[model samples]
Target: MDHLLGEVRAAGGVARVASLRARGHSRRTIENAVSSRALTRPRNGWVAMPGADPLLVAAARAGVVLTCHTQARRLGLWVLEERPVHVAAPPHRHVGEVKRDTHVHWARPLVPRHPDALVDPIENVLVIAAACLPREEALTIWEAALRLELVERWSFERMPLPSSARDVLAECSSHSDSGLETLIPVRLRFLRLPIRQQVWLAGHPVDFLIGDRLVLQIDGGHHVGAQRRSDIAHDARLTLMGFHVIRIDYVQVVTRWPEVHDVIVRAIAQGLHRAA
Candidate 1:
């Protein structure tokens, strides 16, 4: 029926037969619809509309939910790098079959997953990501989540996070404009110097204001054409205003960090971070 097709489409092009039944559809009706090719059985009890997301369909087939870093990336958070497809199997239950490229998370979820859900909630994504990734990499995603208002700081207090996750959360702040911005202050925290993020200066917001005068700008992929020109003009203006500027690109921040670190250190050694 058209109504049955609508229900499946509303559930992101996929629906569980049990859910359809709960919605007052009969088993015979569902079977008839499937028999007429109006819906597809992706797995035993799951029906997918035509052209459903292959990944979600695959997850349903595997009896898991797309989760962890994979879900974080899907949510537009700042992830350090791409990894294999990550999924969470129901705790204490055996997953039937999954793609070899899939990374399965078997940990108990901090938030309960709905039986018909194919994607993990943002909270579960962060907690699982924190446990799975390295300390700093996980912190990047956490800060992005905070910055984007996806999760509140106090919300995590009630959850049973492990020590490592707690440690990472302690370092997270919503002030970070991007994952790279988060990385900067965290890497320089050992200096015990005053650091601020997204500070207004020279009529624009700079990525970071270290100490009193140092302005650090991280240029991501979007810094091209008009944006790039504006950034350069702003750098000139900030320099004229007596603020030290160190503008680095994505590669320098992610791949060649030590070099960037040395530059910042040398600038500090010369008191570039201090007000004249």
Candidate 2:
């Protein structure tokens, strides 16, 4: 019983009752774990630790699994939204409010889902997300998956893609440090201008170098103290070298896109991104 409880906790505080039985624990032991309050049967077939994530438990109880953005967020992938629990069920299954707010996805997964699995596979999540979210956001998740080593680029390319997913994946780049890093180039791809990533300059690397002289820096919240001071000093030296450095923060790139776009356009108009 102790082993079973520990195993459940190790499995993100959740496991199917059958999984415990398969692990050589008898039915009686599972019931005993529940009786001892070390685990709770959130659904008929699922046993979970007391601290199991409520959203996942709810998905289990509702006979569905987390998918798309919801599963991406849970997997520690870069995600921009965190609301309205996104779940996947069989195309025929009817959902009736798992545990308050929910967004039920009816799109059939590109590949068949595992019958006993309670979480969407990473590739399936990306496939469904490609069809559900706008191109840029979907590509961000795909790039994030690539960045995190959650999936390999060649294998993902080999997988079947429906709708505009193939086109979206074509734009995906694993070179980005974050989803926000991807955002800048993806949003500006229409200009047909040269954009280089992780460019070496002044004995350091800048995020993006447009044309020959423009340096576009996407600063996440992590830039601080010595790192921040170093970046500032680099910005000064780059300017002295006749490079135009345009630094923007998370909010500007993610939330206030219009302003960021306008600023970039003005910079280009003034030939800041051109060779001096």
Candidate 3:
């Protein structure tokens, strides 16, 4: 009985009764555990340990996997925005009924899903995300996945990904330090400047180096306390070395992008991006 509960805990606080049975637990053992209140049924044939994640329990109840942007954010990838919880229904199967606000992805997975799995793997998440999010927003998540080494690059090359997804994956660079690093260069590409990312200068990496002399630093949430001081010191050092520095925060890069864009344009017009 303890072993039965252990099985459920090892499976992320949830397990299918069939899966438990396959693991050598008999139906009577499962029933006894449930009868003793050691396990719970979120839905038919599914058992969850006490204090299971509500979202996973809900997914089990609905016979779906948490996927797309939801899973991407779960995996710590940078998501452009939050939306309704996204889930993927099993292929060719009805989900019966779910909340009307739940965004369901019905496309076949690029990777096969395990019957007992409650979350989509990174590959499936990326594929579904590509189909769901706008091109650039999806690219940010893809690049972050690569940068964090969540998914192997070889997977992208070999997976039978749709052309749209393939195109976005092709643009992904593992060197991007964050989603902002990915977003900055791609958005600035229209200027036809030689833009480089994660460039080493003054013994640290600048988020971006444009043309020959301009350094762009993007300050995410982590850029506070000691980190903020370090960045400010770096900006001063870059100035001493005859490089132009433009540092922007998360809100500036995301919400007030047009104003940030104008500043960069003005700096370029002054040849700040050029070596003197």
- Which candidate has the highest lDDT of all? 3
Model 1, C-alpha of 27: deviation from truth (Å)? 1.5
In the predicted model 2, the residue pairs found to clash are none
Error of 3 at 97 (Å): 2.6
Q: Which ten residues in a row have the lowest lDDT in candidate 3?
A: 89-98
- Tens digits of per-residue lDDT, candidate 3, 1-276, equal 999999999999989999999989999999998899999988989999889988789889999999989989888889988899999976688884667899999988888899999999889899888888987789999988887888889967987889888988888877787777778877898999999888899999988899999988888899899999998998999999999999999899888999999999999999999999
Off by over 4 Å in 3: 222-227
lDDT of all predictions: 0.88, 0.84, 0.89
Clashing pairs in 1: none
Clashes of 3: 0
Q: Give one digit per residue, the lDDT tens place, for model 2 in 52-108.
A: 898777877888889998899988888876667788887887764575667778877
Backbone clash count, each prediction separately: 0, 0, 0
Q: Candidate 1 vs candidate 2: which has greater TM-score?
A: 2
- TM-scores of all candidate predictions against the true structure: 0.90, 0.91, 0.92
lDDT of 3: 0.89
